[model samples]
Every structure is written in C-alpha cells, then in structure tokens.
Target chain A: MALISPSGRLRRTPFSDGVEAAGVKAYTVYNRMLLPTVFESVEADYHHLKKAVQIWDVSCERQVELRGPDATQLMQLLTPRPLAKMQVGQCYYVPIVDEAGGMLNDPVAVKLADDRWWISIADSDLLLWVKGVAYGRDLDVTIDEPDVSPLGVQGPLADDLMARVFGETVRDVRFFRFGRFDFQGRSLVVARSGYSKQGGFEIYLEGSDLGMPLWTALMEAGRDLDVRAGCPNLIERIEGGLLSYGNDMTRANTPFECGLDLLCKVGPEANCIGHSALQACAEEGPVQQIRAMEIAGDAVPGCDRLWPLFDDGRQVGHVSSAVWSPDYQTNVAVAMVRKDHWEPGTRLQVQTPVGKRGAVVREGFWA
Target chain B: MALISPSGRLRRTPFSDGVEAAGVKAYTVYNRMLLPTVFESVEADYHHLKKAVQIWDVSCERQVELRGPDATQLMQLLTPRPLAKMQVGQCYYVPIVDEAGGMLNDPVAVKLADDRWWISIADSDLLLWVKGVAYGRDLDVTIDEPDVSPLGVQGPLADDLMARVFGETVRDVRFFRFGRFDFQGRSLVVARSGYSKQGGFEIYLEGSDLGMPLWTALMEAGRDLDVRAGCPNLIERIEGGLLSYGNDMTRANTPFECGLDLLCKVGPEANCIGHSALQACAEEGPVQQIRAMEIAGDAVPGCDRLWPLFDDGRQVGHVSSAVWSPDYQTNVAVAMVRKDHWEPGTRLQVQTPVGKRGAVVREGFWA
Candidate 1:
C-alpha cells in the first residue's frame, strides 16, 4: 500500500483531531473524506469491538437534506421503497435506483417531518442525483447537504455507555427509531441503528463545534468500559454479511439481485422512477443473488478485487468480500452467485489471490 | 501521512501495473479511481516534467458519454457556454453549473459528432448529474461510461517523442483539436491539450486491453529523451494557475467568481440552466473573485486546508492552493479575495497551519 497524499480535496471531518490522537493507522477515502480503517490493528480492533465498546467517527456518511412542499414527492422519486407509511422519528433503509432499475445508492432515510427528510448516504454522491432530479422536474424542494455528522457507539456495552451520557431514557429507543436528546444545550437526533450486527446507537451531531466535546465526554464517561477508537472492522462485517456499496454492488446490479426485494414496494402505492422496471424484474426474478459462503483454506489475502467462483471449470459467481473470522475459526465470504448455484451446501471453487480453494454455500451468516 | 487501505471500491486503472512498476510513491483517489500523486519526488518530478517527456496515467479523468438524438440539447443545458459554434473535432473548456450558478464541475466537452459527446470530467461523479437530468426530462439519450482512458505525454520534448511514435504528421495537430491516430492498429483520439503549461498531447485510449502495450511502447520509444513516469506536479500547477476543482473551487462558487465571466455567455443566443442566475451575477459583479498571490515566506506547508487571509483584524478571503516554486524562488498561491482587497500589490496576512505569513496580491501567475 502507498501513502495517501494530503490535500483539502480529500476532506477532513470534524473528529479528525481526536481520531489522529487515538492513533488511527490506516484510512480509506469515502465520499471524498478520510475514513479510518484501522486503529490498533484489524484483528485487535475486531476483538475489542466484540468484547467492549468503540466510538466511530462515521462522519463520512454524509446527509442529503430535502426540505419544502415537494420534498416527499422528490424522495419517493429517488427510491422504490414506500415512504408514505413512514412516520416521524423513523429511519428506513431505502435502495435508490436509476430509471433502468439499477442501484444508485443504498441510503437510510430519516423522516424528520412531513416536509423535511435526510437521506444518510453510502459512498457515492447521491446529492448530485437528487439535485439534478429536483431541478430538471422543477420540483418545489430545496436540496443540499446539511452540517450533520453521525458518531457511532457499538458493542454489547453500547447501551450502557450511551445511557450514562444521554440518560437512561436512551435505552427505550426502539430499533430503527430516533429521538431528540439534549446534550450541552444542543438537541441531537439519537438513533438506535448502526452498520454492525452488534447493538449500538448513532448520534447525529448537528454542529461542527460540538464534535470534539462530545467525543471527549464519551471517552471520559466510558473509561471503565474499556472503550477505544475504532472503525467498521472487516472481519466482523464480512462474518455478519453486511454489504458495502461500490464493492458488492454498483449501477450494474438491480435491487433484486442484491436480495433487497423486500424493500422494493413496486405497487400503485409506491410510484418511483424505477418502479415499472423493478416490477418486471421482481416477477422475472434475478439471474444472480447474494449468498454467504465458507471457504476451506488456511486464510485468504485481503480481497482487493473480485475472486471468481468456478463450478466444474465454468465461472458461476464472484466473491466481493472475504476475511478469516478468528472467533468462528473459518473463512467467511460474501458472494454473488448464479441462481442455480446459490442453494445451500453447493460446492464450488473460489480463485483467491494465492490459489484456488474449496468453498461451500452457507444458509446464513455467522453472527 | 497514513497508508491508504487497498480495496476493490477504490478502483484501479488499466495503467496501474505500469504505475506500480515505476514505483509510485503516493496516490490520491479521484472519481473513485487511484490517481498517482508522486513517483520519485515532487520537486524531482516537477523539474523532469519541464525538461523531458513523461508518460502520465491520467485514467482517472473519466468520461461521461452522452449519445442519442437529444445529446446536443442536453449538452447545451448543462453549461453556460455556447456550443453552437463548436465543430465536430473541437474540445471546449466548459464550466458546468447548477440552477443557482454554482460550479458543479469544470470539464472539457469533446464533441465526437452531432449526436455524440464525451464530457471528460474532473474528480466528481458528473455522470449522476447528467443521468438524472436526462431521466427526469425524458430526453432520448443513452448515458453511460465507455471504456475510455486518457494517457498524457507531456514536456518540452513531447512533440519529438510523439512524432517518433506516430510519424511526423502528429506534430501538426492543433491545440484543443483531436484527430484519430493509429496505435497498434487501434484508432485513438489524440488531442494536443494537457493540464500544464508545457506542450503535450492526451491520447484517449478507447480500449483497456491496449493500455499496457501503449504505455510500454511510449516508454521504449522515448528512452533516449530521459522519459520517465510522472504526474501533475503541485508546484508547477500553482505557478501556471491551473485551478483544481474540489480544492480551489466547488459547488459553492459560480463561474463569475472564478474569473470565468468570459465563458458564461448569458445572452439571447444561449439558454442554459444557470443562465438567469448568472446574468444577475453579471449585472452586479462578483463580491469576490479568484486571484494570484505571492506569500512572503521561505516555504509553506502542504495546504491540507483553507488558510485564512486577514486585512488588519478582518477576514478578507482564503487561499485554497499554494506551493513554493523552485524556479520562481517564491511562494505562488491561488486565493479567493474580496472585491475591495483584490487589487494588485495589496498586502495581507495569511494564517497557515505553521504560522502567519505576509502575502501580496500578484498581477498575474508566474508562468
């Protein structure tokens, strides 16, 4: 790996000072911002996150705020998910797609009111798409990026640490829900949702000036809980079957191929830009689908590119993400396989960087 | 600087193998692809780029291809510049803006034909914006990214090296005009335009399979000319006043504010998306404009963030790009200055990360 050149173009988040002080070792550029990839080490950080707690500066999950009378209409046009039933203080995982039913971004839409919403995006610049749509159609909505950064608290002890800082009332927040909580006279939207299978809360810090203060307060409050600065661990996410945008999928794949059909409400109630195309896809079914696999090998190298899966000397699928799970003592992988080869216990050969390895399809992911 | 984590998400280009073989020292992510920032050293590469021919893997300058009946109409809608006079083989430097006259990207529009064009973009995902517009307006256009990658050959010896590879007719190619040239029996669009003051040509390689062969051919053909692998140098770009998008300008800036008023044709002949908004800005001149400046200091630190410029105790502007020029023996900078303080020879103080330094507005760039 080579060093990343320093420039204002690769933006720095507000929590960079604390992150640097905590000895972040490696980083990845997400949404043109520096996202920490390692702290102590990949394996050490994975073990620490599972046993204790960690504070993640996920400010790279930028928010695209939509406001005004036509905000709801514009939001519905961007995704196939049904947003009419969504109430205030709810967050829905919406798969944004283009006109041909291709995936654009998989974002979490936070409904603040009838006329205001925030789409917390993945790696791509979803803002340009939304703004272009609104302008081209002459929709009555104001769309822009807001000054909001999400700080994640994850682990088994996440609730305990969050309760101590935000109060015991935080424990009552339901999954995929948020509530306004006051800290230092600033009200913030605290949601009980994160990118990990572990229990956690994501506090949406609205002001840049409050980033360091809140980070320090959390550190001081969780001193006894063995808290540390951490990021989304590769080993844990792969084992849990968490899909990463721009890796597992891109504009070439439809939502149905990614096993996101449940979220695509293509009926009359949900009229979206890709509704007709997705409805046809939902009926015809996808040619390939996502599946969890277990590879029989010592340990695979870092999956920097796609690894081809072969069945009887014929390419049948490809593995997008793979890692050795120390807790499970097996090589866990996420693959997009052909429909015929996606059944459980189907044996195949995965061509890793080192060499070919035997792989078997698993029914479910290891938590 | 920390190491950049390798992943399939941060895309590698077709020329990556050659770039790695040349021992690229650092990289920057542009348009979600790896762009080499250094090979030997910044200063070393800067001097070499001025004297001898160097092959640059500028594949990160992705193309957003627009082809269909509505392609010309769609192109006219995206920028304020008049495309009416543009011939089929010409390339125009277009400053794209949103409805409110904010710069979305500054790319070169390559007119392939009457119904086909390629917007060779900067760092941002300009594809999404184009797709969104076409989809929302129901335009008959097929928008997609083609398998095109540009390899730049730059320096004082560029003509000699290119003539040796493609015959003496290559030396007669006019600036900003592209012609089809055969390389390994494959036709490529070779334009006499590049991102520096030195003379060069950018060959738009249409196929990825020919990337390595072409790269090797160039290297082998120019061995006696001190040919090396290089990239856009920081000091040379600053001295030449080549403003970088996302660093020197963003969506917050309009074309007028970037001193591009001459290109923003808002008369009756042109009807662009930002025409009305830009006309208003033209009637009432910009509050601030881009200017060249000279910092009074030995050398400045790597400009990783905005440096504030103060007049007495009031904030006047900010310097976005700055570097110490080895040839000019002074610190060259590009700054956005307030109208009241943009006059040449106006002295001010710039608050860099290292310390405060005296600065003066320059009449023009060094190159």
Candidate 2:
C-alpha cells in the first residue's frame, strides 16, 4: 500500500483517493476513513535504526495545516509565543493553554511561509479548538491535514548517513535548523530535529507511496551503517524527561507550571485566545510549580500518587512524577510544591503506597 | 473528570465510569463501543514516581477475562508455551504467534483459579481472536472489559512501602506471588510482580471504584514513605531487554527468531494455532535470530531504522533496537541477524542515516 512520492521517496498508501484512519486495523483508502494496519511486526522494517539511520513513517502523528489569509492571525491565537516575529522556514516549541491556564497541547509550530504553517502536535484535538476560535473571528485561515508524511532520519551517524542520500552539504545543518534539498529531482524540506536528544534530521515528504521506496533507498545507501528498527517507548521518554501528553500533564496544567512560561508572551499589543488568563497566571505566580527531586535511597519509586510533603510529619505539598534515573544512579521525581517548599535544598518526605521515604527538591532536566 | 472510587482512591475519569477506555472527547459515551480515553496529563501524574513509591493507574492495560468450560483448552491454544501442568496462581509470559509464526502480541497469563485465567495484554484486539477459537467448542467464557483496574507499587523501596499500607505481612510475599488483604472491608489481592526490574508490588483492585480509596489509604498510611506518581518509560525497558510489541518484535517475528523459544512448546501432543509452523521452525532452525550487540561508542543511537551489518562491505544484518546504556556507559542494541553473524565477536558495520559505524558483537547483559 506504499508507493514512491514525487520526490522519489517511498510514501504511505498514497492519496490518489481520500484516506482516513478508519479504525485500528487498515486505513480506508477510497471512501473509507480507516485502515487496518499491522503495527507490531513492522519492527522488521525498522532494523536500520541504531547504528544506521532510516526514515520513520510518523504519519500517524496528526498534522494541522494552517493556510489562508488569516493563517498568521489564527496561529497567534493558539500559541502563547508570538508568531508575528517568526519568519518562514522557522519553527518553535509552543505550549497552547486552555482558559484555566492548563496546557491544551504542546506542538511544534513550523512556519513554512508567511501565509502557511504547520503545527505538529503530540496529542489533543487542537484543530477543533482552533476552529472554534475561528468561528467569529474573520481570520482568513484554513486548517486541514495535507497529504504529507513526516520522516525522521535519526541515529548517532544520522548526519553523515543522510548527507549521502541528499548531499554532503547536509552535514553542516546545525541543531534546530532546517534546509530544503533537491533529491531525485523533488523538493524536500529537511530539518535537524527529532524526539531523541541525539542529533538527527527530519524530512517531510509531501506525497504518498514514499514509504517503501525511501525505505529501500535508505537501506541501499545505508547498507554500510549498522541500523536497527526502533520505536518510541514510554519507558525511555519518561527516563529522559521527555513529557508525554496523556501520560504527563493534562488540560489541568498551566504552561507556567510545566516550565513553559518562556514561551508565553502577553504584551499589551498582542491578541490571542486564552491570553488574558495566561497573563493573569503570569502576574499571579503559580501556587505550585513543577520541580524535580532526588530520592536519597536506592529504592526507586514508580507511580505512587502524591502525599503531602512532610517534615516532622507536617504537611507541605505533593509529588507528581517519579522514576529511577539510570543516568543519575538514584531515584528522581517531578513534584508540584508550594513556592517556599520548591527551593532546591528543601528536604521533604513522600508517602508511598508502601512506606515513607526521604527526598530533596531539585531541577527537572536530567541530561 | 476524576472521581472517588468506592474504595476511596482517586479513580481516573475512565475508571470511574467503569469502562476500560473512556470515550474520545469527540464522541458521546453512550454511542461509542470502544472508548479509548485520552488522558490529559499522564506525565504530571507521573511526577511523584522517582522520589517516592507511587501507585500507577494502569487500568488501561486491560485483562482479557477468560472463564469457561473450555477456558484451559483455549488458553493453551493462545500461547506457544505448554500450560498442561500450570498450577493456579502461576503466571507465564506467552508469545501469541500467527500462521507464519510471527508474534501477535505478548501478554501475561495468570491462572487465577481452576478454569479461570486473566491475560493482561498490550494494545491489541485479541478478544475476537479468542472468540473465534472457541466457536462450537465447549467453552463457556466471557469476553468483556471488567470494572477492575490494576494498580502497581514500584520503586526500590517498594517492599517497605507496601508494608506501610498492608501491614508488615507484605514482606512475606515472594516475587510473582500474590496475597489477599482486608482494607476498607474489601478484600484485595496484591501481587509482588512489577514491570520494572527494580523491586515492587502490584495490587489488582476488583472494581474501578476502589482506585481512590486504596490510593488515599496507602498515601495516608505511608505519609512517612514518600509515595509519588510514576509511570513506565522507554530508557529502562530497552536496558532491561523488555520487548514491547510495537517496538521490538511484531506479528512478523516468530518465537524462535525472537529469542522467545523458551516460552514456546514444540511437542507433538501440543495444539496451538501456529504450533506446526513453530515446530518446523525449531527443527530447521531460524535463519535469523534476535541478539544483543554492544556497539563500540558513547553515541546513543535511536530507532532510526535498520542499518546494514556488514563485513568488508558485504551485508549481513542490522541492529533493530539500540540506545546509549547510561548505566553500562556503552551503546547497546537488540537486532535480528543471520545466525552466522550472531556469533560473538563477529565484526559488522551499520549504515546510519549519518555515516558508517563499526560494531563487534559482544555477549552478556549491558545493565
């Protein structure tokens, strides 16, 4: 069900007809809105992930296309960060919050051009939210899923591996930077970004049937690199401090609490959805902020719900996330505590499902 | 959307509704057949994980309830392992394979009692498969989502943490063992098995309502123990060699080739869906077997895709899953390679998206 794209890369079952995720099974190609896909065994195709780099069919990650005259104006309403200053070919990590200041979703905003943009989302129906916001506003913008799939070339040697497929010049592409490349006579925008902290590149192929061919081409070109099949696992993401939506923060969490305040901008001149509440949250600091902590013992705690932080059995705040960090050799956790108890040196006690343990507050990032 | 369970635990919205998966925000609950609840923020809820022993609301990992006249017969047909002599209370890790001997899914089968079993599954639609296997057979089993949810107490100090909630008797339970305790006048079965290699316990609350009461009671009782919210992540799972369906082996991987032959039964008397195919595979031996390899570098590779395992520019196989083992301070990976190349010390090359890298097959656990 895969074919070569206009760019000569393999793509998903192409959109000569309409396509939709009918259900868990295979996707409906023509007239059907779903496809019954074989998800697990596909690992055989991912054999080139480790020592070598191969492309990923992350097309399942829903893409919200923003185009039209008011596209820029509409985007400004979604993200707390100002998109006015952003130019085409630029991207930024933006946190979209709800009315109560809770995080709606975290998406990567890619400014393809002045009047066109793409918001690659983690999870959450932001398209509906955007549409609702656009109901009364005469923003000349249209949102839809374009017939394109995002491809990632990741690994230790990702840069060199990709340069061979595209060109030697791709080796100089810095982190967070992107460039357009002509491969097989087709235009493709390659960006130096990925889920892993490891450096790599992401190529958005704008055509169907690009999966197998590109996969074959990468295999042929990368036949020398020892690559392995791999997929995103919940275990690695949490250990690496990568936040998952349904698993991490929900609509109840404000960007300020998730340490996303840097992306929130509420200058008097800027207008956007949920800006007032975000501004209020900014003016009035959060009651509790997300802080990382280190457990003193070898006993790594899993998901035990937060108990009031205690010192001499006195209550303070509660913890939110915790895990055994292989990098740190001790248990680490992210907790929401009152500003006073949020200090890095503050000592606290967490009530576990099993028993009590000693803990110290610290920063969130492990790497 | 969170509500109090009858047992006083804070039941997640879906659990409270007595459903395995809550309805998607886009759909009405009454009309939806399978409600796959999209949680708002699991990451934040997981914040308390590292510092304190946290209880996980893993209710999403549903237990396929099988209790019928021919339950034992059907259960045996589902797994590759021999379950003829399996006693009640014992659990077996079964690899469900298809006609080609590729894995369908791997689920933990716990024999609760005579003719009664529970299969805790990964994300898969297997109820129909089991039902089809039972058509016209004298099996009286029910397939439906239960109101129950599985809660886990994981971390280094899990034992001590459990003792606080269930009293010191918690120390008597062995690994993979379970015991019943009376709390809030409701009897609950607590097991010492957990996903983390680190020690911990899991308690299966019979109904959704028990979530909050148990969670609150444990939190209140273990106030001295730092109980935090935590969830599973990717980093440790790969290091521990835990295979995830969508990540490692898929329906395309046979038990023998996946290094899971130990879990398969290949006797003439045995009867399973893919038993014959598996037996022939055992006899002829697999052309490719999954093996662990130690890459010679500090650079952590991602699941970028399969790279070529080469010797002198000739291709052999590629690595499938790899990462920088922070604990071992080495790059490690799991790969499916030709049996000949799997030999220890076989030098190979990986085709990364970036460039070529050298690797030598090594032996033993990286962690």
Candidate 3:
C-alpha cells in the first residue's frame, strides 16, 4: 500500500483533525473525501467496533440537496422506489438507476419536507446527473451539494453514548427515521441509521464550524464508554452483507441483480426514469445475483480487484469483496454468481491473488 | 500522511502493474482512480522531469465519449466556448460551465468526427451531467466512459524519445493538435500536449491490453535518453501557472474569474447553456479573480486546505494552492483575490497552518 498524497482535490472532511489526533492508520477516498479505513488495525478496529462505541467520520457520504416545488417529482424521477408513502423526517434506501435500469448510485434519500430533500450518496457523482435532468427538462427545482456532514456513532453502546449527548429521547427514534435535536444551540438531524448492522445514530451536522466542537463533545462525553475512532470495517460489513456500491455493484448491474429488488418498486404505476426497463427485468429474473460465500483459506490478500469464480473450469461468477472474519472463524465474501451456480452449499473455486481456493455458497451472511 | 487502502473502488490504471513495479511511493485519487503522485522524492522527481524524458501513466484523465447525431449539439450545450471552427483532429481547451455560468470542468475536447467526440476530463464526473442533458432533452446521442488511457511522454527530450518509438511523424504534430498513429497494429490518437510547460506528446492508448506493452516499449526505446517513471510534478505545474480544476477553480468560479475570459465567447449567437449568464458576467466583471502570488516563507507545508488571505484584518481572498519552489527560492501560490486586492504587487497576509505570512500578488508565474 502506498501513502495517500495530500491534495485539495482529494478533499479533507470536517472531522479530519480528530481523526488525525486519534491516529488513523489507513484511509480510502470516498466521494472525493478522506474516509478512515483503519485505526489500530483492520482486525483490531473490527473487534473494537463490534464490542464498544465508535465514532465514524462518514462525512464522505455527501448529500445532494434538492429544494423546490418540484423536489418530490424530481426525486421520484430518479428512483423506482415508492416515495408517496414516505413522511417527513424519514430516510429511504433508494436505488437510483439510469434509463437502462442500470445502477447509477445507491443513496439514502432523506425527506426534509415536500419541497426539500437530501440524497446522501455513495461514491459516484449523482449530483451531476440530477442537475442535468432538472436542467434539461427545465424542472422547477434546484440541485447542489450542501455543506452537510454526517457524523456516525455505531456499536452496541451507541445508544447510551448518543443519549448522553442528544438526550434520552434519542432512544425512541425508530429505524430509518430522524428527528430534529439541539446540540450547542444548533439544531441537527439525528437519524437511527448507519452503515453497520450494529445499532447506531447518524447526526447530520449542518455547518462546518461546528464539526470539531461536536466531535470533541462526543469524545469527552463518551470517555467511559471506550469510544475510539473507527471506520466501516470490511470484515464486519461483508459479514453483515452490506453491499458497497462501486465494489459490489456498478452501472452494469440492475438493482434486482444486487438483491435490491425490495427497494425497487417497479410496475406500470412507477414513473422512474428506468421504470419500463426495470419492469422488463422484473418479469425475467436476474441472470446473476449477489450471494454470500465462505472461502476455505487462511487470511487472504487485499481484495483490491475482482476475483473470478469458477466451477469445473467454467467461469460462473466473481467475488467483489472478501475478508477474514475472526469471530466467524471463516473467510467471508460477497460474490455475484450466475443463477445456475448460485445455491446454498454449491461448491466453487475462487481465484484469489495468492492462488485458487475452494468456496461454498452460504445460505446467508454470518451476522 | 496516511496510507491509501487498496480497493476496487479506487480503480487501478492499465499501467498500474508497471507503476507498482517501478516502485510508486505515493498516490492521489483522481476521478476515483489511483494516480501516482511520487516515484521518488517530490523535489527529485521535479528536477528529473525538467531535464530528461519521462513516461507518465495519466490514465486518470478519463475520456467521456459522445457519439451519434446529436453529439455536437450536446457538446455545445456544456461549454461557453465556441466550437464552430473546430477541425476534426483539433483539441480545444474548453471550460465547461453550468446554467449560472460557473466552471464545472476544464477539459480538452477531442473532435474525432462531426458525430463522434471525446471530452478527456479533469477531476470531476462530467459524464453524469452530459448523460442527464442528453436523456432529458431526448437527444439522439450516447455518453459513456471509454477505455482510452493516455500515456504521456514529457520533458526536453520528449520528441527525441517519442520519435524512436512512433517514427518521425510524431515530431510534426503541432501543439494541441493530434494525429492518428499506429502502435503495435493499433491506431492511437497522439496529441502534442500534456499538463506541463515542458514539451510532450500524449498518446491516447485506446485499449487496456496494450498498456504495459507500450509502457515497456517506451522504456526500452528511451534507455539512452534517461527516461523515468513520472507524474504531474506539483512544483513544475504551479510554477508554470497550470491551473488545476478542483484546486484553482470549482463550481463556485466562472471562467472569467479564472483568467479564462478569452475562452468564453458568450455572445448572443453562441447557443450555449450558460451563454446568457456568462454574457451578464462579462458585462459586469468578476468580483474575484485568480492570481499568482509569492509568499515570504521558508517552506510551506502541504496545502491540503484553503488558506484565507487578509488585508489588515479585512478578509480579501484565499490561497488555494501553495508550494515552496526549490528552484525559484520562494513560496509560489495560486490565489483567488477580490477585485479591490487583485492588482499586481498588492501585499496581503496569508494565514497558513504555521502562522501568518506576508504575500504579494505577482504579475505572472515564475516559469
């Protein structure tokens, strides 16, 4: 691994000072911002994240703000998911697709009001797409990236730590729901959602000026809770089957193929840009689908590139993410396998960087 | 500096193998791709780049291919620059703008044909914007990122080294003009241009399979010319006044503010998306404009964030990029200054991370 060169292009987040002070070891650039990949170590971070509370500077999950009378219409046009039932202060895991029913981005659409919304995006530049569509159609809406950064508190003790800062009322926040809370006289949107399966809260910090102050406040309050600077651990996320957008799926795959069919409300009634194409895909099942697999091996090398999956000399699928799980005592992986070869207990061969390894399709993720 | 975690999301270039084999020391993610930032020390690489020829794996300069009947129309809608006089083989340094006449990206538009073009982009995701426009307006065109990786040969001995590999015709290629050259039975777009004041030719290698082969071929052919693996040197670029997209200008800036007013032909008949808005900006000159500044300092730290510029406690502007030039024996910087403070030789105080430093606006860059 090479050192990441510091530049203005690869942006620094608001929580960079605290992340550095905590001695972040490795980083990955997400949405053109610094995302900490390791603190003590990958395995150490994973263990700590599962056991105690951790603060994640997920400011890289940039928000694309849409504000106007046609905001709801524009939001509906971008995804196949039904937004009519969504109330204010709710976040929907929307699978944004292009006209070909291909995945452009998988973002969380946070509904602020009928005329305002924030699409917290993954890796791709979905802002350009939204702006282009709105401009081309001459829609009565505005699209741009606002100065909103999300600071996450994850793990089993997340609730206790968050309640200490935002009050015990935070405990009542339902899943995928958010509430306006006051911190240091500034109102913030605190949501009961995060990237991990572990219980957590994501505070949508509105201004850059309050970034460090809030970070320090959390650290000071959670001193007895064993709080540490952490990031989304690869081992834990893969085990939880949390799919990474560019890594696990790209524009070539539809939502159905990525096991995101539940999020795609495709039908004649749906007016998404990829509605008709997704309807066609829904009729005929996906050719390849994302599946959890366990590879028979020791610790594998970094899964920097795709590992081809084969069954008896025929390529059937590819493993997108793989990591050694200490708790599960197995090498867990997420693969996109062909329909013919994707079944529980089906044996396959994964071509890892070191050598070939035996792999078996699991019924589900470890966690 | 933190180590960059390797992952498929941070895409590896076709020449990644060659770069790794050459002992790449550091990288900066550009357009979600691994861009080698240092092979040796920054100063060592800078000194070497000024003398001998070097092969640069600038594959991060991704191409957004626009094909079909409405390609020209779609292209015209993205930039304020006049494209009427552009020839088939010509490359134009066009500054792309949004509806409000703000600079989106400054890319080199390659005219392959009337209906076929490639906008070799800078740091941002310009593809989404182009696709959105085409889709919204129902234009008969396609937009996609093609597998065209550019391998640059730069420095004083560039022409000598390139001639040995691609024949003498490469020497005849005029500045900002390209010619179809054959390499290993594959036709490539070889243009006499690069991201440097040093002379060079950028070969638009169309296929990824030929990346390593061509890389080795250049290294083998230029053995006597002291060819090395190199990247866009920070010092050299800043000294040459080569503006970086995200660094020197962003969506908040207009082309006129970046001293690119000559490129903006915002007349009534321009027929561009931002023509009218830019005409208004042209009428009322920019409030703040980019300028070259010389800072009085021993050595400036890595400028990862914007440093605010002050004039006797009143905020005047901000410096975006600053570096201590070993050759020039001064701290060279690129700053955006307000109209009242942008005049040459105007003194200002730059708030660097270390402390306050006196700075003066230069008439031009060092080189």
Between the candidate structures 1 and 3, which one is better when assessed by TM-score? 3
The candidate that wins on TM-score is 3
Q: Rank the candidates by TM-score, best first.
A: 3, 1, 2
Instruction: Provide all candidates' interface root-mean-square deviations.
Output: 0.8, 21.2, 0.7
Cα RMSD of all models vs. native, in order, equals 1.2, 19.4, 1.0
Taking the tens digit of each residue's C-alpha lDDT, what string does model 1 give over B72-140? 999999999989999999999999999899999999999999999999999888999999889888899
Question: Per-residue lDDT for A165-199 in model 1, tens only?
Answer: 99999999999999999999999999999888888
Model 2 lDDT tens row, A1-367: 2110010011123321222221121221100111112222222322233345544445545567999888887788777888777877777888876544567678788888888888877654465456434533435677666766666677677887787788899887767667888766778778888765555887777765665555556656776775333334223344456665533465667888777788888768646656788888889978777776676676544452444567668777766656565456777666667776888888899886557889898756564
Give the whole-model CA lDDT for all candidates, comma-separated. Answer: 0.93, 0.61, 0.93
Ranking by DockQ: 3, 1, 2
- Candidate 1 — which pairs collide? none
Off by over 4 Å in 1: none
- lDDT-sorted candidate list, best first: 3, 1, 2
The candidate that achieves the highest DockQ relative to the unseen native structure: 3
Which ten-residue region of model 3 chain B has the weakest summed lDDT?
A: B266-275
Each model's TM-score? 0.98, 0.48, 0.99
Query: Lowest summed-lDDT stretch of 10 residues in model 1 chain A?
Result: A265-274
Q: Is the docking of candidate 2 incorrect, acceptable, medium or high quality?
A: incorrect
Between candidates 2 and 3, name the one with more favorable DockQ. 3
The C-alpha stretches of model 2 lying farther than 4 A from their native spots are: A1-367, B1-54, B136-138, B219-224, B304-308, B312-315
C-alpha root-mean-square deviation, candidate 2: 19.4
